[model samples]
Target: MSGTGDTAPGADAGELPAYAERVLSVAELIPAGRVMTYGDVAEYLAEEGQPEGLPAEGGGGRRVGGPRQVGRVMALYGGAVPWWRVVRADGRLLPGSELRALAHYRDEGTPLRAASQGSDDHIPKIDMRRARWDGRQDERDAPWDD
Candidate 1:
């Protein structure tokens, strides 16, 4: 991966953990100008299919695709995808790469909220209300949609 200068385990051999591949694919599916938080990505994957590294329900095993795990996947293998589209739940720009992310957000017409005048960095935040993508284009008949 081209991000953070540290390849994930097995990355040097052009391989990624199956979970990492799933996360990256979700990142790719996010439309330009829209975003998913790490939690959202994890939840989406969970609702859609059986995630890698996760045991089936009632198996009493640990799960591996929570928000933090999703974030780790992005940090390691995100550069090949639209990394900026995966954002924090609070809508704050990614630290250390705020400017770069801002450029991508602007280019994609993603909604943004201006920083308050008293802010130190004065960086705009993503407008989560407007920019968050839930991966649902229509109301599914699932009970959870209630």
Candidate 2:
């Protein structure tokens, strides 16, 4: 986990740290045209030391390590994975890499909101309501809660 940034996880006879590996694994599971927030990724992995009072099942658990740590792992060791599939909570593209990420999103047919005329930079955004993936069964497919 300490080297030139060009090397990908397991690229040079080395492996990513355990937590980072888990994070990248979850990133890989995000299907094409869908996305997960950093927090969602953390919850999906069920990392240890989750905060209290959140349920362990059904994606109600508090995420472990929070978003910044997840971002760090992605920055450090995520080049080989579909790094763009992990995104901000608000569904905005990653700063400094927006165009590159948007290219992937377009190619995958991820839903997007066309930029409004009044938008600060007129940059399109992810249509999160239609595109968010929580690593769970579709609500339509789940049995009724009752």
lDDT (C-alpha, whole model) for all candidates = 0.76, 0.72
TM-score for all models, in order of appearance: 0.78, 0.74
Pick the TM-score winner: 1
Clashing pairs in model 2?
none
Query: Model 2: how far is 8 from its true place, Å?
Result: 3.7
lDDT of 1 by residue, 1-146 (tens): 12633344446777677677778877877888889999988887777354354334434223557998888888877877889999999999988889889999999999999997998999999989888887754323121221
* lDDT of candidate model 1 versus the reference: 0.76
Off by over 4 Å in 2: 1-13, 47-64, 137-146
Clash totals, every prediction: 0, 0
